[model samples]
Target: MTTPAQRQTALLVSVVGAVIVALDGTILLMAQPVMQRDLGASVAHIQWTSTGYLVAVAALLVIAGRLGDQYGHARLLFVGVLGFGAASAGIALAPSVGWVIVLRVVQGGFAAFLQPATLALLRLAYPADRLGKPIAIRTGAIAVAAGSGPLLGGVLVAHLGWRAVFWVNVPLAFVIAVLALTVRTPATQRGNSPRLNVTSAGLLAIALATLVHALADVPARGWTAAPTLLEFLAVIGVATMLTRHERRTTHPVVPPAVARSVPVTASMALLLVTTAGLFGALFRATFHLQDVLRLDPLDSGLRVLPLTVLMVLGSPAAVAAMRRYGARRTAIAGTVLVVVGIAGLSRLGPASTWMAMAAAFAAIGAGFATVMVTATGTVVGDAPPGYAGVVSGLKQTAMNIGPTFGIAVAAGATGTAASTMGSTLLILAALAALGLLPASRLPRRPARQEGEHDTTAALPAQAPTPQAAPARHTNS
Candidate 1:
């Protein structure tokens, strides 16, 4: 049995691991220019530092999650954190940009291991009904880390150096490892230990990597560019082959149960569109702020502080709303807010006031927080415990893909100029409005409350058995 203290420690570890990863993603954006000049790297070379990491993480997430399920989440978490820190340290002392890019990809590999385990750790510690509040807390912490990254990065980069930003993750990782050591995570993987289907895993990885590569190129190369078209065709072909293989494979990277769960599948879709809208708008706004408005990086970050603030506050509020109005209703409400916010963004101009920008940011942040918390809760709570790692991985994979999709579309619209910001944001707003389709698919209410017997096939507290049929809800 998980003690209350152990539960709390697990939460801490999850939050810390999550924050470092999210913070690292945002913080590095601020440091890139400095790194470029210092390392004498070309724009293309510096772009790979981020692209390589993104491709590596996106490609390997499902496989990493499967590994965590077969092994133990705690063991994977420990190794992932250690390796991530080591890679960060290596980047800090790297002799050239090449080393930095290589180490970054290594760091991304470790991060793929770390992320799903964070959620799996939570699923292990908390009962289904009690998951929302902790997830809300985790969501809030992630918002804070992500929101403050640019400001923090600016401070570190200005006062200390670009390398200081990376150096910070080492101590944080050490702290996570120490706290994780005290948590008693029982071996939670259930069912027969089937052989991993390496062929399917490889295909999925290639598909995801190719998809990201194809999308990332949209901004630089037109959609009709030969290289872009070829990459996309490759993605489609590999995805088709992976689908066929998975249908036949007994041990798919994404568990069969998870693939079949409507709530899980819908939640993943919802997360993807939601993030795509959020990040696409943010990506465009960042350019409009710095390049068009001629604001410094710090000032640009501050103007959008309202978004962060709302995300922090809205997470808990969203959970409360979920309990009162149900996931479906709450998600619809949240999606509406995002649509309105993005529409508001479309009205921004070179002469727009900070107050106008802040209002739009706040609305988008609040809406996103609500949907994210609700969808994440549904994804975790609706699924059986045995498949938590893969589910978490699937959830994370949607998140990774969404931002790239959003950015690619937005980049295609705006190109290198801020003159088309208005039209580009309008396109994003339309895409966000489409999220209503998935939002409507969430459960009208949670199937059961906190103290009630869970209907899902959960491992017994004393003796986990393979015979338990994890209950699934299509439209509860």
Candidate 2:
């Protein structure tokens, strides 16, 4: 068993890993314009930097998760961190946009390995009863990283240059590596460890790539473009094949039995819908603030502060609510809050003030924090022992895909900023409403002892049974 000090050290390492993953997501967003100018990339090529990362992250998450289970999570995490740091360096020194995009994909693959293992490691490090506080702290770290990345990236890119944004990961990575080396955790090995389902992985990757391409293209090519149609078809076909393969395989990426569980399925579904809406809102709002509202990059990043603040404040409250009200109720409430928050955001117009924008973001941030914490708890809590890594990968897959779909749908819709916002929120509200049906199906608490005894006593009894005959004949 790990000592408390070791557990604490593990949590710190996990937190650092999470920060690095979150940082990568936003850092590139701010650096895109600079990279385009420096590398003479067309808009399409520059956009690939983000698109490739998302696709790779989504595709490899499950594989990485299983690798952690088969090998030691701590070992996999160390390797992932090292790989991610190296990829970041490559991105920093890339001679062309093409190489940068390639490295971003590699970085994302490493990120996939790191993310689920962090949570799995935490589960191992902490005891069940005491897990809430540490999970809350971890959630807070995620919120902080999410909120800070844009601003930090903006500063680095402005003064130091775009390459500096990637270079910043080096120090953080080194520190995290040192901390991770100190953590003590149990080793894991799968006897006759399953072979890599290379075919499934390839298919899924292709599907995600096509889907992202379709989404990205919607902004440039009208939705009716033939390429978009073909890409969509390709995604559907690949997904179907992948699903069939997983269902038939002895050692599937997502075991069919686990995926069919009510709690697991519900949690995954909730994550998918929530991610779609939240990421869509972020993408749209970012563009709206910068493009339509004409704010500078620094100001734009600062304007998003309210969401971060609310996320930080609300995460602990969410965990508390889960304990008191149960995961189902807490998740339902959170989804409602998200609906309200998105509605508030939909009200924004060209004339809206920064304060108004901030208020909307605050609602979204708090609402999402509630949903995220509860949903994660529900998923992890319901996962079977020895399968945490697989389930986590599934969850991450939903997370990655949802945002891509959301961005596609939102960007495809025709409207002014206000109208687009309204449409997107309406879609989010619909998805949130769908979450209520499943939320209602969570297992009910067992009856109290007195209630159970009283119920037993009320049952009708059969007639008294006669005693069995003795074996007296044999003695005679």
Candidate 3:
């Protein structure tokens, strides 16, 4: 067993990596105009600095996660962190917006690699019973970073310029990469051997890229646009083939071995639904606060700072709820809070009342905290002994996809920013309501003992953990 000190180090390294990626994901928004000015790029070109990154990460996250499972999480984490650091520096020094956009895509790919490793490492290092707190803390950290990223980026841009934003990630990634080399976690032990079906992986990559691109176009091009329709058609066609291939293959991207675990599936669904609403609400809140209220980015970020703070502060309570009342009840309560939060946001009007906005943001953050903590812990805990990476990948993919869909839906709603935002929040409230049933379905507690390692929790209790499940090779 690893010492507690080592586990702490592992958590620290993981948290560091998570923070940089989460921050970079949205932080650049505050600095994009400055970047455009510096590069003499058009609004559309500068915009891809963010859009391309999102699409790339969404496309590559599952593949990266599978690779981590096949090789080693720690090995991948080290490479990912180092690569991200290099890409960040490259972006900072780029002379043109196009170069920066290209580098940002590379940065997102590195983020996909590092993200799954962090979760897999935490799952491996900690005991099952004790997983909630660490996961809660991890979730809280990432949430706060993501929620308040613009605020931080605004400060960096004002003081040091846009390049400072990317430059900040370089040091953190280097530190984490060094830690990956020095620290020995269970992730380095070489366990599950995930097989990659080239055909399926390629199909999934293309499908997701096309789907997200189409979703991204919804706001600008409308749902009826030819490009959007064509993109959806491509997604559907590719997905059908991929599904057929996965069903027939032994070592598909999802790994037929652990694909059917109800608990795992439910957790992923919970993540996707909750994040969709929560992220949508966040967008609406930002637009309402900044666009309607006429607050500057910094001011808007500051106004919502309490909401970000509450996300971090609320975790201990969530951890307590999980321990005392069980994950099922706690998660149910949390899902209800998401509905409450979105419902509160739906009440937002042309005037951004202080009390109404404050309360809504708080509810969203607190509620999302519980759901994120619970879903992450459950997805990891319920995986079959050899498929942590697979489930982890699936979980992260839901997360990435959630915000994409949320932002798209909210953006596509009719009228001005505030009006459409209000519309989307109402829709999100409905989505949150639909999530209630699944939230209530999670296991009361993890099925495995704290010290028992592996994805064995999803397997029959009496079954031995598949310590070395190898990649499959089809018969000729």
Our model 3 lands, by Cα RMSD against the true structure, at: 4.7
lDDT of each: 0.84, 0.72, 0.76
Candidate 3: where is the Cα deviation over 4 Å? Answer: 187-194, 350-352, 415-417, 445-476
Q: Can you give the lDDT of residue 454 in candidate 2?
A: 21
lDDT of 1 at 52: 88
Please state the error at residue 474 of candidate 1 in Å. Answer: 13
Model 1 Cα lDDT, one tens digit per residue, 322-348: 877888888888888898898898898
Whichever of 2 and 3 has more lDDT, that candidate is 3
**lDDT measured at residue 120 in model 2 versus the true structure, 0 to 100:** 73
Clashes of each: 2, 0, 4
The lDDT leader among the candidates is 1
In candidate 2, what are the lDDT values of residues 1-476, reduced to their tens digit? 57878888988988888888887787777899989999999988987888788877876788887777677677778888888999999999999999998999899888888888887777566533345566677778988987788888888898999999999988888787777778787443344346557777677667766776677677666578898888888889999999999878766666554566677677778777877777767777777777888888787778888888999999888777766666667777877777777777777878887788888888888878877776665565445435557667777777777777667666776533645666776776566556666656553332121112121121111101012110100000
Better of 1 and 3 by TM-score: 1
Candidate 3 Cα lDDT to native = 0.76
Q: How far off is residue 130 in model 1, in Å?
A: 0.7
- lDDT (0-100) at residue 459 of candidate 2? 10
